[model samples]
Target: MGTDKRTIAVRFFGGAGNYANVLERCFTYVLTDNPDEAALFEWVKSNTRATSDDGIRDRLRFLEAIGLLTVDEDRVALTERGIEWMADTEPKLLFDALAENVRGFETALEALLDEPKTDAELGAAIADEHPETGWSDPSGPAQHRGWLQSLGYVERSDGTNSLTDSGRDLARRLASDGPALERGKSYTQQELEAAFGTSFGSYIKGISPRTDDDGALSYVIVKAREDGPYGDDLEGDRFTYIGEGVPSKGDQSPTGANTALLEQAEGSTVPVYFFYQPADSSELRYEGLVAVVDARYVFDDDHNRMVYQFTMERLELDHPAEFETIAASVTDGGAASIETADGEESEPALTDDETEFTETQRRVRSGAFASRVKSAYNARCAICGTSRESPAGTVDIEAAHIYPKRDDGRDIVQNGLALCRLHHWAFDAGWLAVSDDYRILVADRPDLEGYEEFSRLEGEELTLPTTDERRPHATFLAAHRGLHGFEPAAER
Candidate 1:
């Protein structure tokens, strides 16, 4: 039974670590002969010398935490999910398959799962495993680990680890067939140019995926004088006009000066060019022109349904007379009529009046105060080095106040540090705190065993902002330490 079970265990985990090996062995032992704690502990002790009784207990606890096993008094049994997960040939395979379907993280993940190491361990191992694959940085493995963990391919507990059922299935699927290589498939610039033509290629320069809709993108091209209604005078306007072409909701509209000009030209039925000159500048350059298009032939891009391209058959260079008529009509004739007849008596000053603050005003005031605190901390969270953007763009830290606003701490800039949200909550709840010199401290708790990521953050020096005067207040730190009953040495 032991030999058969060992064979089954090896087949189930497929060259995993000591903890995984132990769990499989335990499950096999339990299924073959229902063992009590004493018997199970003895079996584990004899099988793996690297794990102590306490280590074994912790491993079991970790498994229970992950819903793989359950313990009642001294007896332990495999969970139905755990039993099914172990019995399955390819547990992590589904995650790999899904990851393969997406371009970004799956390739790195497939490589990592091929070996059964924890993220940190896997990151360290990647250099040795595939030194020739060009991704030699230590962060490569770390990022892969984070990606896999985020995607639920791997589960970790108290420094021990196990492959999630999804990860197992993914592995099996990849083993049977070949691993997906979606990351290797991307369109090159030359390929794109060949496929879409030069004009279409130029259109994609400012194109981006539309925020409000799925399956649609947006393109904002700089329209030349030959393309739209304006000419040399309005050429330099940064926001030539604001328009939205929504396909899903079926709402399309053009607005601003362009729309106004387009409406004026509709009366004459003639193509016209429009131009606006800055009062301060004398430079004249061709801007945009409006030309009649065969409405039947205009076709929008498949990727960005909002953008349309039409064939230009003829070029016309004159402004329609209706433009001048419309412009003159809307020129505020009343203002032109009101001649300032040499300094008429001015109106008297209005008296100051008391007013109640609206809810929006109150919130705005609160946000303003929070901004001041965040500025004081130089837009960085004091506990962790989380900034607006990491060098790699992975972590984004936010501004957080050390003292709660309800506790009478002023919402001034002096009270805030830019911290990641997690660290902000930790600092507020007293699970963590900063020293006068801005060093980090963590509360002592055994149950936070799995929180190695957070635990490793303690005692690390904070990355101060560029300004020297924006340092955290010593008075605030002293008061906090006094209230919390813990103090650390100050920074040099």
Candidate 2:
């Protein structure tokens, strides 16, 4: 019987540094040229400076240990999956192979179908499945869950876990489809180790840290419109980054590269940095380290096909300079000045003096405030009282500012309300306004195209936040009402 998976893994990755390459090379050699096991064993011993076959056999055994090889007598062969492994360049596939060796993965996956389960509960089932091993330990389920999540097969909210769309798809595929590993080949690199049988190994590189084919870190840059995508409470921190078009033109979801990344990003931290291109700039600004949180499938109207959307979470970096860099990048352009102002640089351009806020501050505040308001409101669009999931696969609510930040509006939840696109645009255009009493106020536009819809909304009470402290600030609502010549209601 093969050794314990944990032990095999520990030894496989652990031995002499140079020897680690042997198995991968050996696998590659087999794929490139079918060779006998005796010949491969001699090849390993010759290079390893060993007189006996024991060391090479142990190495071969370890490979067999991970379900990567099959050895019968003097013949060595890579399983169908092993053949695909040579050219396949994805780490998730590596994880999938590794996960198969983990004892309780099957049981845990099945139990998750009926109801959500906690990591510990899943751990118990794992323990039951692998009674001879320590698969019942907490880490067992957590590790399995991490793989499931990383594979986009599951979603964990709070403490409970449930199957995601990808997870469900995988289950059905497993039931109806043939074995997945036997498909195709990776063709990464090929050459014999100049050995006797060649079955022992080849000289190609094994898995490296997740990176582009050229070894550079990968990144996703998104575009945010000034008043639209980016604002004081939303669209900067964790937004869907894509354009609706063909692969080269900005349609990211349909692009094959991004879809694979979205899968790897789930459950796993980012393998590359993330950046954002502001509405007007030609250069990209570093956002921060991010994790691909989830994927949503939606029809791309422009592409006229269903596309994948990747959602990401921004992680705090260690240094303050990172944020400073982002701030400077956003405010990159300079202006002519007649004279320097007191306690300020000599630039003549109006600072926050006119807009009452700088673009830099607005960007910094938008991401945080947006997350807060959405969390506070449970990600519901306040105006329509309905769920709005965007085609980008994110919560489709906009954290509309009760008072325009341009007018020195506060970036607080009380100064924000989550609105869908229609209401947000209407409010911004002064076509619809909210009263100080949290009531909807549509301007009596006699000739507007959608006059009847506005008429229907004339007295609809706004969806208020759960706590009074977080409710729309009465003063801010009054200011918004004041902008459109509507009377402010009496104070509470």
Candidate 3:
């Protein structure tokens, strides 16, 4: 073995799909149970589905490859990093171990940031970048993608794979210790503080979008939850984030986080990092380095109070050409609106032309196309027969384009499937597809972590509509299969 380059090999482990939790349990067992080599094998066989002692040894070798464990002829023990992981058991500790010890781990993740890549393309990029790994064919890319998938770093969609928000954050963090610049990635509070080299002061009471002592804007954090009391809207990939202030309170003053963001709209040079925490989770996702395109105070009927709202553009993502033209108009002269303390309105930020532009670009999808597909499938997921209906009589079923609208696929019923959110995302991501014979076809990469459930759905018949005309067209299905690389049963 080369002393510098980490060797690439195929090592199978029974409970590796969710390796972090699985390894944490295994480490705890080793520490408390105090099992010797033979006793450990017996414990693994009893506790997990590991059927043989050889398979358990393979798992040990896999751990050893990542520098988490050491296995001798008669003894096994955790390394210093492994012991640290055992103490904390955070997923980042394990991920850090992989990046430091395993060659190409960071590179493999960074490759997915640009766009989705096929497994072969992803592997080839890693092998090409770090030639010292000597990785060729089956071993190089497959194991890397699988490990990333297991760790919830990469997600497959629309016939190609890309990094998940968490994975994107990890890739960015590893690439540079400097300020985070990537949009749509996520970071913990601690991670953000480390990246910025400053404390946020306080998340509970202090104003978000914290300002430095010199009054330079640090970053903006939004609790942008859909179900939250405050309203936040997204259009053309731009977010209209609610400014700081409680809804139950009287009219909000343009102060604290709100003022920090307003200064950007008023022509500040500093780039603002936009972070959002969902209603369900504490993880603050980085929206991007944002520019405040528009900001204003508006009356909220629901909360019966006046609040400041900032319309932000994620600098990295594309926007409509017309919006760019309108933005130039706003930047040239139009002043952002604000309500004075005496309850008077100021000059509106958006001109009449800009308002008309926003209205025109508000919705791009056809409601009729969505309705027809859902009605055809009885508003249920074609794969799982799942349907989500709120008490307000609205269903959560989504209409998926079989051949994809971006490729000029039509909005007709034959090219659509009414699916639940999970199936819709899965189908779009190439994790699952439907065969010509109306059977479900899952991606065959079982080496990927957390693939067991999806793998089990392979070859399961799809739930089709009653009439032939309403069914998914064969041409469209074939196109989807070709896009996702799903071969027919005979080919397998």
Candidate 4:
């Protein structure tokens, strides 16, 4: 049989010198001043009576032990608790930190509620109440009494000590309600539904985007796999998501769940919650709120099709500590009962068909179309005949779609043009268009900064392919010209 050892909740060191006020002062200084290790040590030495270097270090360690500060090798900074204490410098804040972190802090204080007791009496009570701490030393009890006295929770009357008015109230509250810091509890999918009144049955795959009752997008839940078809990149706090589609099929389109995610782009009212499962654990971790900063379509390889890639940034929330329940809901099971801004559980409208990847094989056909267009132009820009070759012997050319894929453009060689980076940008920006007679139609903006360069190529005939079947189609050229507000350069 294996033996189990009781773990100590918190370590309470005696001779920490100063009280809560001194700790708060130090915390405020560190937060506002942003001091380094030397600066903090010097300040603590000068401000407080801890003159020796070891004494200053001990004070800093005590602050860290109480969860007020985090002392790194090079820097010393305030923790979340320390920052909160600065905002609300109440005795209860200090009391909360003490009660949670320090062993027998409440036990000693509660013992003095009815009558006054000396340090020895409080020590006896703490030892009896919390024998796991094994605090046989007298310093442990003296330290607790000193901290309570400094916090004004307990006052010494002659030889004995008793709880103050505020101390008695806090002790009673601790006994009845316990500490304010509520630990997170992990629950299954059924339990989350019981708590928040929502169903997550539909969003079991890659991207699960849902709408509210009013037909407006509510929230999006993205399930990222570590070894999935689409590789999701996590750099720092930003997660770059590849739009929905499998590799065996075609490229990903901005439709279904992909469109739902795009709808919540930057300024949209919809909230997006990211959940990912690590390789080691079976649980899915809820990575708080994320806002989609960017979304664009790009083609990376000849084997793959153009896909919409979105960059999402994790937003800093006001009350991050309150995310314990949400975290548990996502991690325990692959479901989350999200709370809206108004603190109400939103019943997001989700259907099985809405999130299905019903995209056609257009991407598969589009990749072949791009290859034919580039090969027709001999891997050179048709406008300027600029054939840029990389050091790796790969030609730099993009197969530009005359009618964009977003507008249901057919992925045929007749609707594509092979252009270099500069002309591709100009064509996409509506600064250039194609005519029916294979001539370049510039936007004719002479007043623009880079208009002269483009205007020179206005009447230049586009480089045509030897095969008539691979040539730019007149219908697609007319669509491009009409879309860019350009008249035909030549008559039939």
Candidate 5:
């Protein structure tokens, strides 16, 4: 009995149409036999009755165009890259066909090709490129192109065109390996510390993840270092709160005492740090202290740290009204009451027993505090308008002591404004002052030029806060001007 060529053709083409069978057979024959063009054509004609000479020639030319087959004169051979490509696509219809079905591999292949084509180019080529397959919706191919671009197999040049090289290599590797590669673990201690601008040892020790066994993905409890020692203690041994579970692997539930200690630490003002001694005797540490300045100030890694450090505090102060509004809404039902020394009821005072700084210390701290407040309010220097984009970007700015620390001017939030170094010096020297309504004033210094800019600002109002409640205290400003030997700027 004759070898069943029709059965072989049917087996290859079954669900796939004529074109797929032709391409697969061509690939299989070329790969196995290493034949030139004329020989390959002759072999195809002898083996398969459906392949016409003209049709065979056209397919070969198409393969050459798409870089599947290379030709030298009348001779044709698969290149080593082409052989690797064939191996990369093995059994013809399995992965490559599936990739084309899923849009993953096809997109990757398009990117690997030199001079990537645009969507229209790809759409036009799809019929010729995937000749055996018929697409009912163009969107499938279009979506595949997008998927390829996302996977880094194809890059868009200009705005409309796409191409790839690295993506092709990656796709091929992924297809051969069956898409089960594990993602690499997160940063080591040194790496995490470098990224976060704080010690990882301190952070992990302070906060425990909400889910004990699930790693640090959920809610966390802050550790209290100053609140005294933790764990059931009496003997001099340190009972590390590694987690709610066992010190060794086989243990499931954490000891009862450790759970109680963790529950006590949650939502407390005091920071918590966590230390874990692994079963392998390796130690892992993390810092749990989080400073809520502004989103800008909280650095996650090196790329974001510098920007955060420079702008976070300023952003926080500038939008104090917003923060206050948020705080009010959240704490409305549980507002802390304040009691004056004269036994009068009042709103919560800024200073209390729990406050970090004393009144005298707050006065001294006002100079630095004011600078930070100004930096946030102005978003840059108030004078000379020095901003992040300026050539001399780091021009020194100070938070001029509106009320002098020596005179007991309070370091409270309201008595501050952003000022450049020059303006700060001028203010300190009693060369300028602001009215209760925030108008700028020039001192009666004969040496000073007091140009149109300075004169214009004299009665012009400073930018007011979004919330009226946060307006600078007129009494505080008046007290500052009086102490500084300057009359207040007249109201606009």
Candidate 6:
């Protein structure tokens, strides 16, 4: 008759995280203190490792439902039944209730009293007591262990378990009661298959990679240059990248390569390595392991298909010296470059043209940043709109700093302007300059041979970065004017 009453709860809440474990601790804590709901939650937050806000709130409702307590807004007051429970409440009462339906709760806890056991060892013991119960399943055991920890009865470390102070007391009480052990019911494989749509076995998901002729996915390369976009986005711990569109060569479906990327991003330590390099020189910098936490689908007009926007969380990185070694092995990532504070030069990065730079304000200047910036400007010179492309991945123009870095300039988009080789040389030689109002101010140098092009830029507006952050700062222009000694047209 006693076991029949327990069976009812097991039928309903057995598979659910054990209810009695949290209930015993909640009742005992309340009897000792008349804490308000908020204050009591603070205590729970500090004391328990596995108890959640929803779990505690649900248990509070349960206590009130059973006439054990009365919850009045913020205040929690114990009823007479609750006071009696405080006098002699033990963990076994709840364990016995769960054991009736769950099959292995009582037996597993009892086995722990003898010695600390690994999960495999404990699961073996649970299987011996009730072979048909799902207690041996790690998915199920995690909940049982959480329940025990919530009750402050046991702790597990390094795959071994041991009883805590509360557990010892509970063990003594259960030993004296000498409860009878019997398998309440045997859960069969058919029942398991029916419960879940899939068969009662492991679901193996794998990496669906698109193999190149060389049989490897290309590394997602980042160009970290001093004058290009800094890795400021990654410093905050989360890194987001918008990869090139799907249907990447071999697959008929758009999601072919993207599917592999998503699988690689699953929980914990995913084996995806991100590398970084500076602009100009061919060197790579190893970043670290990252996992894909979220992915979004956005339409790409370039390929007329959807591209993947992956939000990644970084795990750990190799040491700085080791990263430098890794980066040096592979080069030609075509990122922008910049000079560090210590006079160290990194990859040549890129920046976006005025339209996009103004929107993102990204200032890091790596080869990648350079590529984006050049694309924004259509790879043309900002002053004269002239550019030439080379087959060896070299441009006829170079990104020039509005305010030279040698004079304490930063490699942000706003401070950079793409110029043809002739104009780049002229600007650096102070033969030409840009006014504060963005007008071109070619110096009056009659001695120069190509006077038509130099004279053409006198009133031309300089093309800008996409966003305000990437755009050149006013103070930088003022400094450049100081060096070249050119005033705005309006000032003249």
Single out the weakest 10-residue window by summed lDDT for candidate 6: 5-14
State the weakest 10-residue window (summed lDDT) of model 1. Answer: 5-14
Off-target runs (Cα >4 Å) in candidate 4 are 1-18, 177-492
- In model 1, state the lDDT of residue 433: 69
How much is the lDDT of residue 343 in candidate 3? 89
Task: Assess the local accuracy of residue 1 in candidate 2 as a C-alpha lDDT between 0 and 100.
Answer: 30
Highest TM-score against the true fold, candidate: 3
Error of 3 at 361 (Å): 27
Error (Å) of candidate 1 at residue 445 is 2.0
**Taking the tens digit of each residue's C-alpha lDDT, what string does model 1 give over 1-492?**
211111000011112223344455678988787777777777777776635667667656645644567766568788775677569523343233223332224334455445556655654454444444444445444434443554456666775345575555444434332112122133333443352233344333211111113532111122232232222122222223312333454323343322322222121122233222333433223233333221111224443333222222222222222222222222101121122467553321111123343432333334344444454555566665556543212225454544555555433344556677778777766677677767777666648753566677777887665555455555555555555656554532
TM-score of each: 0.27, 0.35, 0.38, 0.35, 0.29, 0.30
Q: List candidate 5 segments past 4 Å from native.
A: 1-386, 389-400, 448-457, 488-492
Q: What's the true lDDT of residue 187 in model 2?
A: 17
Stretches of candidate 3 exceeding 4 Å from the true structure: 1-3, 9-12, 51-55, 72-75, 157-160, 176-492
lDDT tens digits by residue: candidate 6, 179-274: 111122222334423422234244211122323348554222222232332122445557665543324542123345455554333211113444
Clashing residue pairs in candidate 3 are: 156-429, 157-429, 158-428, 158-429
- Candidate 4, residue 205: Cα displacement in angstroms equals 40
Q: Candidate 3's residue-wise lDDT over 276-366, tens digit each?
A: 6676776676665556655677777888877777777655522222222222221211123366899885633211232332322222223
lDDT tens digits, residue span 352-427, model 2? 3444434434554455466566656777778787765555445567777777866666556777788877888888
Evaluate all candidate structures by whole-model CA lDDT and list the values in order. 0.43, 0.55, 0.65, 0.65, 0.43, 0.51
RMSD, each candidate, Å? Answer: 28.9, 20.8, 22.0, 22.6, 24.1, 23.1
lDDT (10s digit) by residue, model 5, range 236-305: 2222232232223333232333333322221111112232323343324332222212111122242222
Query: Relative to the unseen true structure, what is the C-alpha lDDT of residue 378 in candidate 1, on a scale of 0 to 100?
Result: 56
**Candidate 6 wrong stretches, greater than 4 Å:** 1-369, 450-452, 465-469
Residue 418 lDDT in candidate 4: 93
